[model samples]
Target: MIELREHERKTLLIVERLDGKASVEQVINESGLSDAAVMRAALTLQEKKLVKMKEKKQTIAKLNKEGKLYAERQLPERRILDVLYKMGGEALLSNIPKEVDISSNAVSVALGWLVKKNWAVINQKKGTIALVESLLTQKPKKGADEKLLELLAEKDTVVIEELDKNPQQAVATLKRRKLVETKEKSTYELELTKKGWKLVKKGLEVAEEVTLLTPELIITKKWRETKLRKFDVTASGPAVYPGKVHPLQQIIQRAREIFLEMGFTEIRGPLVETAFWNFDALFQPQDHPAREMMDTFYLA
Candidate 1:
């Protein structure tokens, strides 16, 4: 959705031809463009945010899991003494910036400070978290999920792989219990025994609802729950029209309008589709330089 310069646009075409990724020479050779022109095009592509450069070199990112665990721990020795009960803590240390964008040294220092206050403990070997006396890590106890798994144990379930990724654990647990048996392959293979449905129903009742919100939560509907809900009519909606849609939507709409005005019919499809429609139909081939998720749609 980023805008591009003429040079960048050319580079984009070349990169698309290469499947969203290409080396410097590849862009030049494929575009039939000069070397300098290609380099300038590539730079322009990067400037407009349509392209990102990975310098054929190894890149290392740090992750600070320990820091995260530790920070989730509590504070203030006086306040801690007043509390009757305690529960779960936050992240631990050894998390580098790559993991959660935190510095390991800073995290370590903070933990040390906490330890001095008798607020937290540090044990690198066990990856230990100082959970409070009330802490309990509980997974859902939905026996219903187990039943769905039992039905799915049949050989011929169509969406087996999906179930595995999304609901496999319950399935495996049910199968292990021997409540439902796999009898056949193909054509809706398994039959759910009385036990299976019962398990699934039980699971549905006990399922927990977890919510995570971020500042940019508006990007997804599910994320909206993370924001503070306001019922005060005094804090109403915008009084005057902002006269703006999301920037990406606005730009894309303008582009479509321009193209329509120029007598080009708009082509509409999902961002998730086969590579053929996204690239080949657009005059790009397997070797094209520009076929990449950043520059184009990700087929998967």
Candidate 2:
């Protein structure tokens, strides 16, 4: 005769009906309970030694906006391959930009993947790319990357586990293309303990009495028969963070305010300027570390 909360009882019934093992997602769908409620019930059951919760952390891969667009139109590499095939399976590397609709930024990306796939060979001296036998024979086929692209095109998002192909290979390739992002989260699976089975065999019953002493129950003199939920004074409450200005911004603003209060004039510098104006004019040595190409950004 184990006493149970309404939510805990609901969870147990759902799990028992589910053949003693089910994912939190399945329980949520079958039990029609919110995710938080299901998790809370599961936690409570675990504490009572009636059920065990096992967590499997998985990394879910999802396509971004640009990925969706590329999936719809095909990857730049695939398109470039098509362009090369149309040119009799060979073309000057420079001619690809002229023949294909791919952007300048994407040309290198497409070429890199194309060469990496061994679909084409670059002749540095002649600046020409020679396609392999597969492309020339019209027998080259779509691999994991192409399949993933097609799958993503039809769906807004897909977990890596749902893929019918090599998930790791697909995720790795798409990640290099900057087409997908991964997020890791723990997925919980609930299982009944021996005690839980014993309790179930003993016939657990749902408590008909309400836990809250509502105003209606009090007015109707039903509060005497209803069970009031016990409050845990030691339980932690939700954290509170008072909003404030960003730390760096606040510091800059305070510095400006102090300068103004001291009768000082504030000056601004050009964010974008020629090297001569930014360095030479300031008498900064040309060999200074900050003048190195890696240290500064140059607008193209």
Tens digits of per-residue lDDT for model 1, 227-289? 343234776786897586998998998998998999998677764777776678888877766
Best by TM-score: 2
Candidate 2 lDDT, 1-300, residue by residue in tens:
567887788889888889999899998998788999899999999999999999998877778888888887888888888888788888988888888787888998888888888888888999998788766887468878878877767775677765665867888888877899888888999999999988887777656547567799979998877766656799999999899789999999999999999999988878898999889999999899998879989887
Minimum summed lDDT over a 10-residue window in model 2 is located at 204-213
Q: Give the TM-score of candidate 1.
A: 0.19
lDDT, each prediction: 0.46, 0.84
Model 1, total clashes: 44
The regions of model 1 sitting more than 4 angstroms off are 1-239, 296-300
Error of 1 at 43 (Å): 57
Q: How far is candidate 1 from the true structure (C-alpha RMSD, Å)?
A: 34.2
* TM-score of predicted structure 2: 0.71
C-alpha root-mean-square deviation, each candidate? 34.2, 12.8
